[model samples]
Target: MALFLNTPKLNYWIPKLIEESEEELILIVPYIQTSKNVLNALNKADSNGVEITLVYRENKLSDYEKSKLLALKNINLLHHPNVHCKCYYNGDLLIVGSMNLYEYSEKNNREMGILMNRIRFKGQETFASRMVNDRTDVFDDAILEIREIINAASLEKASKKAKQTAFKIDIIKTEEDIVRDRCDRLNISFLNKKFRTVEYLDNKWFAQCENFFDKVDVVFQTHRIEITFRLEQNELYNLYRAWMQTYDLYEFHGFKYYWNKPDQELLVYKHDNFDWSTDNADCNKDKKYYEGLSTIIKKYRKITNK
Candidate 1:
C-alpha cells in the first residue's frame, strides 16, 4: 500500500530530493519568489549539473523578479498561466505540496504536502512514455498562448501608463565637511588612514556593523576604535547572535546600530570616521577608552576572521 500523510516542513524533503535526484528534476510552482536559501539550493543543483525544469505564472512576476530569474544560466522560467499546482518530481518520486517555495511558507508559516512514488509496469510503460513525450508539447502550447496575451497587452497604451516610474539623483559632499559634521557628533575617530580608505567603497560593511550593534547590547571601554564592515544576508543574523553570545563581547566603531526591522534605515554615527594621533600622549591616558576600543576591534576581527 502507498503511504499517505500530511507533509509539513517541506524543507526537510528538499535535501533528500537533492541527494537522490539523478536524471531530471521538475518543479511546478504557480508563484515563484527568490530568497537566499532558495538560490543557494538551486545553485547547488546546478553545480552538480542537474537538469532542472521550472514552470511558473509569468504574469505574476515583477520587473525586478524577472531580471533575477533571467540571470540564471541553467534555469529556464516557463510561463504557464493555468498552472496553479505546486509539485516537485525527482525521478519516480513525486511530491504535491500546498507550500509555495517562499520564505514565509517554507520557514515560518504552517503548510503541508504529500509524496508519491510511481512504479514502472510492463502494461503501463507505453502510457507513461507517451505522457513523458507529450508533456513539453502540451505545457509549451499553454505557455505560448499566455505569452501572446502578455505581448499584446504590452503594446496597449494603458499598459504603458500603468508601468512603474523611477528616477536617479546625485549628492555631493566634501570629506572634511562630512567628518566635522557627522563623525565628531558620534564620538567616532575620523583621522585613521584605514577609516579614510574605506569610507566610500560600497559601505555594506558599515551596514553589517550597525546591524550587529543593534541586535545585541554591549559595554564599551574604549572612546575610539576602528571598525571594518561587510554586508551579509539577514538570515545570517542568527550566526552573529550565537557568536556574540559565546564571546560575551560587543561594540564596534563604524556606524550607529538600528532596530531589527527589514525596512529600517541604517543609523549613522556622529563618529562614523575618525583620525587619531599617537603624538597625543594625554589622549592615550584614558585606560577605559583604550580597553573598550580594543575589545570592540578584537571581537569584530574574530567574527570576520580578518
Candidate 2:
C-alpha cells in the first residue's frame, strides 16, 4: 500500500491503475472535468471490455453531460448528490483522495491524497469489496431514478424540439434541415444532436450522431449561442492540451472545457452570461450569432481534423 501526496501523481497513477486493470475500473469523484489523456485511458479501458463504474455527484452534472455518459457501453454511472469522497479502484489498486477528476485539480490545484496497492493488504480482501459495495443514500436513489429516464429517452426528440424552438421562423423547415444542410455544405458527417432546457424532463435530452472526428455541436438557446464539443472521456483532454499549446488560451474568453468523465464538453459561447429562464430568451435574434458560430465550427473542425 503506497500513498501519493501533492505530487501531480494522479495524472500518472490513475491511468497506470486503469491500464493495469483486468476486470473492472471504478472511479468515484464528486466533481469532474478530467484531462484528455486520462479520459483516453478510461475510454481505452472501456473499449477493452472493462466494466467501468462511475459514482459521482448528480448536482454537478449537466443534462448534456448526463446524455453523453449514458451513450457509453459496459459502464455503470451512478449519481449521488451528497457524495464528496474521491475514491478510485480497479482489481488490484485503490486510490482515494482530496483530488477531483476535474482538470483544475489535475493541472492547477494543490491537491493531496493517498493511493493504496490492494495486494499489499493481503488478508484484508474485504477492503475492495467494501468500497465497491458501499451503500447509497436517499439522494443517490433519487438520481438513479432520474438517470433511467434520461438514458431511455432518445436524443433526437430533444434535438428536434431545440430546432423547433430555435428556428421557429418560417424560413426554416426543421432543425434537421439546417443542421443537415450545414453538414452537407461542409462535407462533414451528421453525427448526433443533444438539447436541454431547465423545463424538459429534468433538463435532459439526447440525439444520435455519426462516429466522426468532428464532435462539436452548435447549441442554440434563447439567450446564448454555444459551440460545444461533446466528448466521451479523454478526447477533450488530448484536444485541449493541443489547443492550449497552439492557440492563445487567454484570448478565447468563454472558450473552455468541462468534464465529469464519460461526459465532457469543450465549449465557447457568444455571451458569457446567460438568463436561462424561458421568459428572458429570444432565439429569433440569434441568426447572425449562429452564422458566426458555424464559421468558427468549420475552422475548428479543420484545425482538429488536421
Residues 200-231, candidate 1: write the lDDT tens digits.
33221111123233333222212223232333
Write model 2 residue lDDT over 98-146, tens digit each, in one string: 8887877787787777766433122234433233222222223433433
Local distance difference test, candidate 1: 0.44
lDDT of model 2, residue 7: 41
User: Please, what's the RMSD in Å of model 2?
Assistant: 22.0
Runs off by more than 4 Å, candidate 2: 120-306
Reference-based lDDT, residue 175, model 2: 30
